[model samples]
Target: MARSRWLPDQHGAWAMLTVPFLAGTFLAPHPGPAHAVLLAAWSAGYVALFHGQQWLRLRLRRASRRPAAARCHVRPGLVFAAVFLVLGIPLAVRHPWLLLAAAACGPFVAVNTLYARVNRERALPNGLAAVVPACGMLPVAGRLGGAGLPWAPAAACLLYFWGTVPYVKTMIRERRSAGYRRASAAYHAVAIVAATLLSPWLALPFAGYLARAVALPGRGVKVPVVGAVEIAGSAALLLTLLLVF
Candidate 1:
């Protein structure tokens, strides 16, 4: 049977969500088997729930003859599930029941994403901005173990929220402005500033790009050059974080 075109693309969403969460998890503290299970369970359940709600909403919208935006919600869920099942199962089994708290938190935040999408009428990008922090926090909480909330996870969430704000605002602004080609540039600027406030080692090079972007008005600067420099600098910083920190 052909799949309905209106069905949500959870796999893609999962893939996108995994990147920052995995990156933060790698940088943050580690977790044991029990915590791992809870994280897996929570992540899995969230994905399932997201798809279920999206399906229900699509049906209702279709029945009302409202135009449906092409769905991308399910994509991330599928991707997250694939990664978690493949990697998380072994760890979960070893720890047995350590991840319950993280599991509990995942659905709470995920429902917020869905509610924002349905009630507030947020677009996919906005929904993602709301969802990503919760996803990122899952592994961090798992690593912390127990139900104890820590300052670092809160800090990480705050940093992510701030980083996403300009990006989201720029996305909205660009819809109305022709001269908004520098949206990514603006995002990099905000990211650099936030990173500086939180972690200078990660922030300085990002700030350098922001400076270049600010200085290079109407210079027709090569985008590839800027992108290459950013990528190289980010790689170097990651290497430093691994080796030195």
Candidate 2:
């Protein structure tokens, strides 16, 4: 209970948060200290937001409300929030324009906040809303490196992360929903075409993703295997983007 309440259980989020940032920074011709600082701020902000949202989700309930459950999340939430401000402020001061990038997430954050209040955080809409900020970090991090690269990686990140919303739904919450499986497969099919438009190299990873989307439903695939495929898919995207640029 202690560890579980403090950290997020969404395993896929780790990749979603880290990969785009890493890809963006490295893809830049001149990766620098600011990018590292942004990474720290970004990670801390995520941890903080997760804890905060969990507390709110638990607190907003009345019938099943547990004060103890709500209390457990407070310390970590505030601690990480403080750490984020510490890491984020100076960087923001140096680059005032960074505020614009952060502000771009406002609508998504509003969506997430509404869902959290209603205890629907696991819904597909909420999950996809969360992906926007994480993927948005890709371009923002790339910009921090102070060099211009092809926008292909940023576009690839958007397509890959957005597609994960439906694909993962077909594995978990919506696993038994045949409609979800179809939707996931269809999204992957469209993603393959979008990837091809971004770069012919990108189509390879999307094809692999599409193959998994088509083949892996209702076959009792293990949780770890699903995670492994996602990790591999993400790495494949990263590598393919590098090759494309």
Candidate 3:
């Protein structure tokens, strides 16, 4: 079966990835009404921009296949505008960050969508994925009257990176598997363990890593000093988390 480029795939994956970061940002100590508004606006705007690009790409691809130009849907833009209006109104009243976040959504979604479209063969870039959450953490930390780039968010990003390496390997191997139930179970288990050792919500790294493990199989991929690296990384992550929290 041919994949529906506009419906799901890389774009969808990136969208889902944002959830944990959003949760972490929101869960941080009182972010105030302004931050909340900013977060919501940012999320909504991201969805709109992503969907718009998908629609445009789908149309362009179709047009290339036909003798005549293809007609594209106008509804996407209209819907996005409506959504932005509804979500942006409240934020405009009190918090400017909300509008700033919303504004950021257009660029973020554009960059990710373009990358996914261009880099179909390769796995999503971890460094790129890390950027969003890091940015999200900034406003959130600031709202709490702390430095935006504090140790906590940095540790969280590092943990996310560590877990993601294994998870990406898994995802590549099991791309067509429908055994999400098993994957989800394993993910939750790792998340629980990490959270216990780290922070309750810090489990995102574990969950993200688990997803990569499911996607890419690493059963035989060997590293010369894997054990040492794991031990060192884990120790560092723990120490950082301990110091931050």
Give the poorly placed runs of model 1, Cα more than 4 Å off: 1-16, 23-43, 64-129, 132-162, 165-173, 178-191, 208-245
Please give the lDDT score at residue 207 for candidate 2. 90
lDDT (CA) per prediction: 0.48, 0.85, 0.47
Q: Tens-digit lDDT track for model 3 on 85-112?
A: 7877875665555455546545655566
lDDT of 2 at 65: 54
Error of 2 at 240 (Å): 1.2
Of the two candidates 1 and 2, the one with more favorable TM-score, higher being better, is 2
Quote the positional error of residue 28 for candidate 3 in Å.
4.1
| Candidate 2 similarity to native, TM-score | 0.95
- Return the number of clashes found in candidate 2: 0
Per-residue error at 167 for model 1, in Å? 2.1
Best by lDDT: 2
Q: Using alpha carbons, what is the TM-score of model 3?
A: 0.50
**Selected candidate, larger TM-score, 2 vs 3:** 2
